[model samples]
Target: MHIAEGFLPVTHCVAWAAVATPFVAHGAVAVKKQLKAQPETKLLLAAAGAFSFVLSAIKIPSVTGSSSHPTGTALGAVLFKPPVMALLGTLVLFFQALLLAHGGITTLGANVFAMAIVGPWVAYGVWRASRGAGASMDLAVFLAALLGNLATYVVTATQLALAHHAQGLVQAWLTFMGLYAPTQVPIAVIEAIVTVLIVRALSKIAVPELQRLGFLPEPAQPVAQKVGI
Candidate 1:
């Protein structure tokens, strides 16, 4: 959910921006290192960014009179890790704000914090944990995308509640959460399925790229036998 321009107070806007700065900065370094180390995956990285941008840009009408959209941050987070998505996600938000007026420049930091920073981290963690527990790649990706999308909304609701909490903080949060859940739930599931499909397709077609990104395990080498005999 892109908070409208000028919706948040100046103090809140500044506070969010300050909090989000370091993550974006770290993300910048991570991107540079990744590109230098694996130059071949540059196109793959661009595809991930495009996926996030296209999905997030398709705003849907929410039951709360606000809008809801898919937070497509999970794919990049799962592929390149959370830090990489942090930068790509921010770039997606920046361009959306500038060109589409989907979000505003003033609230860029808050949007980035929710959609880029927290969402990717949550997705990456879920993906890692699910895989560690022996979940299939499809299952892990599905769970990661679903939870990550929901987490973004939860954080956005928190930000809104904090900014406009004259009616008591807890009440405000509950109200916002209630309004968002109706639309966001189905969208999250859809995003999860879409992510899984994309990953599945990539598994077949982009095997080398996925292996380079560590999405696929490297092939094991055979050992020489009978030499001693």
Candidate 2:
């Protein structure tokens, strides 16, 4: 979900942009290093960004300035790691701001900080934790995407509360989150399922690519059978 144009105060917008700049900068370097090392991943990377763009573009109005939508960021975080996803997510938001008027250029930085940086890291962390606990890839991805989408809304709620804190920060946050919950929860569940399906499909077609990215392990060779002669 995006914070629409002119929805946020100018000072808040600048502050958020300043905070997000370093992460986006680091992400650019990470992306360059990744492509240089594994040029084969470019297509997959593009697909990840496209997936996020398409899903996130489906906005349902919620709250005052924000909306509710599935954030399709977990796939990229799982495949390329969170750093790479920061760039991809920001790019998707940027295009949507300019072309689709979904989000605003003024609010781009805040949106990036939430949906791009915080969301991907949360998703990646969930994925790693779930896998470490011996969960299957599909289950891990589902949890990662679900929790990541929720995390983005939490951050957005906090941002809104901070900007409009007359009723107090905690109360305002609760209000925003309560409004978002009805739409966002179902959307998060759907996003998680869709992310799992995408990961499974990619695993079949992009085994080598996934292997290179450390998302898939190499296959073991067959043992020789004893001769019966």
Candidate 3:
């Protein structure tokens, strides 16, 4: 959900940009570490960027005369670290705004905060928590995707609330949440299912690639594979 320029007051835009600045800086540091550790990760980052660009551009019509698209941050976080995914997401949003006019330039910071930062960080946190619990790869992926999708809507609602507050609207936050929930909840469930299927397929055919990217668990006991086979 891209908030158009002029939709929010200048104060809110400045505030979000200020808050997001450190996140963008931390993302740069993470990208540097990833580059140092795996030189090939540059190519992977490029691919992720391209994939994110395409996925975000393909919008599905929604209520409110606006459209929604898969953030793709969860997928990237599952494949790489959240910081790197943030960078990829930022770049993708930048290009989407500049080239495609999919999102407004003035609201880029808000979009980055919501789709790039919130989604990836939530997904990463969920995945890490699940991993610590000895959850299966599929389960980890499912949880990450679920949280990511939900976080997107939450962030969007918060942004809309801020906008309404700036306009001196009554009960702005609650109103925004009520308006957006009807559309976002179903979309989140659909996205989670799609993410699970994609991750499951990748887990089966390209386990090594996932391992190299630090995305999947270490090989389970050999018997696990035999049972599936």
Candidate 1: minimum summed lDDT over ten consecutive residues — where?
220-229
Range of the 10 consecutive residues with the lowest summed lDDT in candidate 3:
40-49
Better of 2 and 3 by lDDT: 2
Residue 171 of candidate 1: its Cα lDDT? 100
- Per residue, candidate 3 scores C-alpha lDDT tens digits across 1-229 of 6777788778887887887778888888888888798776566666566756776677777676656666767878878867877777788888888888877787888888888898989998999899889998778878888789778777887888767785555577677766656666676666777777877776687667677787766776788677986
Q: Candidate 1, residues 66-167: lDDT per residue as tens digits?
A: 789998899999999989988898899999999999998999999999999999999999999999999999999999999999999999999999999999
Task: Supply the global lDDT for candidate 1.
Answer: 0.93
Alpha carbon deviation, residue 206, candidate 1 (Å)? 1.2
| lDDT score for residue 149 of model 1 | 97
Per-residue lDDT value at 165 in model 1? 94
TM-score per model over all chains:
0.96, 0.94, 0.84
Ranking of predictions according to lDDT: 1, 2, 3
- TM-score order, best first, reads 1, 2, 3
- The TM-score between candidate 2 and the true structure equals 0.94
